[model samples]
Target: MADNSSGGESTFTVLLALGANAAIGVLKLVAGLLTGSAAMLAEAAHSAADTTTEGLLLAALRRSGKRADRQHPFGYGKERFFWALIAAVSIFVSGGAFAIIEGIRTVLGEEAEQTLAWVAYAVLGVSFLLEGTSWLQAVRQVRKESAAEDLGFFAWLRRTDDPTVVTVCCEDSAALIGLLLAFAGVGLHQLTGSGIWDGIASLLIGVLLTFVAYVLGRINKGLLIGRQADVRLVRSIRQRLDGHEGISGVVDLLTMMVGTDQVLLCARLDFDDALGAADVERLCVRLENELREEFSDLDEIFLEPVPREDPDIRARVLERYGENPLSTRSAPGGATRSETPSGE
Candidate 1:
């Protein structure tokens, strides 16, 4: 279960981030206007960008939830990756780039005094608290999902298949850092009566955002291209097939994660020697039904019967499964028999 965030939990997190950002963005703009602070203005833009990204993630969640169709046999799950990529780009451009430009413009052109500086400080406190609330929810989801596999939290996050969850979490984290920078920048400007501190803070915030966006973009690109399904699910499916009385040995197995909760599986296996055509057909149906029951996330499981000596198919099987079927036997060039299953 790479992304157990397949249900309402992820949407709730995105909505929370959206709400927090929307409120914080307005406050930041007001504070910036009142204080004439460049850092506050950049913070407002960053918040506004985060709100837009959250909306995109929500749309991805909704659109990717639809069932498989004739137009898309694999279902629309990849839409989550698509929208997450867009959100990452938006953060880099709308948030990071704009903030840098604003910072540069302010440093070059402004000699303005920061009036009502206390108001900006007050807004920073409120924004930090709201952003923290959103961040906690995202972390809770991440921790819950990671603990089930005994995997380190950061390890799970890197390969998480649910883009919506990752997007919201990353955005909120960057928002928190940006808020701190804004606060420090404003404070320094007030103390030294120098606008350079504000401009410098804005630049640092932009760099932080760019780094987050770059990491997110690369990860989402991998998802769009298709990463392997969870290792747990892969091993589980293999073990389940081996346990089936009708199956002799698995010849080939392929899995694609077409959605957060939906996985498409195709397996080529050796059935019992005595099974007739009708028996094999019935076994396929039975196996598919059993797998669906055991692993509800299996959107489709197509079991194909193939002989152990299939040359071309064996090559593909070796390529995908990364094991030599012949060598897996007691004798050379003999087929491996799986009367019992084992783990890696």
Candidate 2:
């Protein structure tokens, strides 16, 4: 099932992030103590925050996968969004805020540059390797899913309806950039014999983390508020309905994503008058059955029928719905008046 697959992927991604963070944290902590580099210390804090967030994400994934209960009719799907928000907050407070403070102290000349700074550089190099591996894994997963939907990697990451994958990718990328910043800072400190360079690097790393957290927060907000399905998908559904029997054309259509893969659909369809109300009812049933068969992820569907012989009916429906109606509309003066807004 889609839910099962999603849960599994989330679990794997969380573990991957946690594993990488743990390794990097150890390296950074050791490097920071040996070289006393502000940037290295900042990076260690970032890694620590990342590890904590990963643990929270895993818990959220498990809770979100729970079945619907009497208290929560929609299930615990929104739990992911809640935890994602918490993770972003953690990044901002633990990583961004702390780095900024440390960078300021270093810049104020309160701290002295460590003479033996090579250790920081060595640790940064190793951290980069580990972070890069984690990033690659997340990218690979996104690519696999995106390819099925005919999207490029970055485009997919931006447009993906799944917040968990987006969050993981964003965090990994920020961490990779932080490693580079630390390397640059330590290298400069070694060259200039000044701790200010290290401080500047920490500040920059904080800025990057803040930016990434903001983006992730925006994505999670959209997911929580509920976003409409892609327009192209709605058009495809319309095409399908147009092909059905007794259905003249699609008048109106609306779709919203219920979850990552699930969708809710509502449509207004035109039916030939030759088919009475009973016949139209049967046609509606058939159309619903066909759609369900075609798109297994469709959750709820609503079909409204209108008489096809009315000249202005389709126009009115189109005007109101902003899509071509499945059936034709009635003219201005006729027995079956245009009850709805027409595209006159």
Candidate 3:
């Protein structure tokens, strides 16, 4: 889950990438036209794709932030995943496809003489600087958010619910590498007087963009389908439930990420047989309030009182967690202890 600060950071990152890509795209177009470098043209397409992606991401952020209404009881959080998925498709279609086609045509057709090569070089250098600035901003945001969650950078990225920052980071990183590939293509063409290197460079850039698109697409797909909340958060919730005085044991716990910073949690617990109906009702209300206060990301919660030793429930838990599904014990302080559940 993300915080308000992370959301702001994501917006800033997207805006920066948007500005840089827009400017870089125009420059690359001009340079490609003047130089007749296939790689330069491919890079121009890359920037165009990135610029369009940024616009879609802006829409994602805005639409996904809408408040829940009758039409969408869970809010519009999944809109972000949908838009991000579209952006990935845009990258592959507009950028990778164009670059690949251009590369093939240039390689097979009559080799055109590279002209005004210096212009391509100048454009690539400027584009690198702008893309690098955006990349750095994205890195800073990811680092801060990952640190807040007490997870390694890559681990956090893989599990993060926020898609805006991840998309920006990946696009800018690809842009920078594409610029380097363009530079190499131009330089080699000028030295060897062969457009083959330029074509090869374009092919490589296409492949790179395709790979990035695939990775992001897979991520957004899983997210849109629904994924579990952070493992640490799940563990913390289970520990709290196990330690509660009224709860004899936890039968089952379930969680899902509903939005960028929202989670839905459901817990089945075994209450003490001594507690009356009124007491159990009060305890349930108290637990809901307390859990929400403790973990701000818990947007929705449901607690069900159940018998811990029910055969049906025990079988379900066992099916999910193997033989040791009930990893419960008593500590020296008379506190209930439980390990991280396998369901998470």
Top candidate by lDDT: 3
Which ranges of candidate 1 are over 4 A from the true structure? 2-6, 108-110, 320-327, 331-344
Please give the CA lDDT of all the candidate structures.
0.84, 0.78, 0.89
When summed lDDT is taken over every stretch of 10 residues in candidate 2, the lowest stretch is: 335-344
- Model 3 TM-score, all chains together: 0.94
lDDT of 1 by residue, 84-154 (tens): 99999999998899789878977888577889999998999999999999999999988988786687888
lDDT of 3 by residue, 1-344 (tens): 66866777788899999999999999999999999999999999999999999999999999998999999998888899999999999999999999999999999999899999989988988999999999999999989888987888888889899988889989888988898998999999999999999999999999999999999999999888888888888888988888999887777888888788888898998898899999999999999999999999998899999876567887777677666536666733575544336454
Task: Compare candidates 2 and 3 on lDDT and give the better one.
Answer: 3
Score candidate 2 by TM-score against the native: 0.83
Give the Å error, residue 324, model 2. 9.7
Best first by TM-score, ranked: 3, 1, 2
1 versus 3: better TM-score goes to: 3
Measured against the true structure, the TM-scores of the candidates, in listed sequence, are 0.90, 0.83, 0.94
lDDT value, candidate 2, whole model: 0.78
For candidate 3, what is the lDDT?
0.89
RMSD, one per candidate, in order: 3.1, 4.6, 2.9
The all-Cα superposition gives candidate 3 an RMSD in Å to the true structure of 2.9
Best TM-score among the predictions, by candidate number: 3
Across 1-344, the per-residue lDDT of candidate 2 in tens digits comes to 13336657767877998999998898898989888899999999899888877887887777776876899765676687788888888888898889999898889867684856778778888888888888887887887787877878888777776677787888999999898898889988888888899999999988988898788888778877876666556666777886777776565566666666666788877776578878888878888898888877677788988555445755655465554344345633453323222212
Worst 10 residues of 3 by lDDT: 331-340
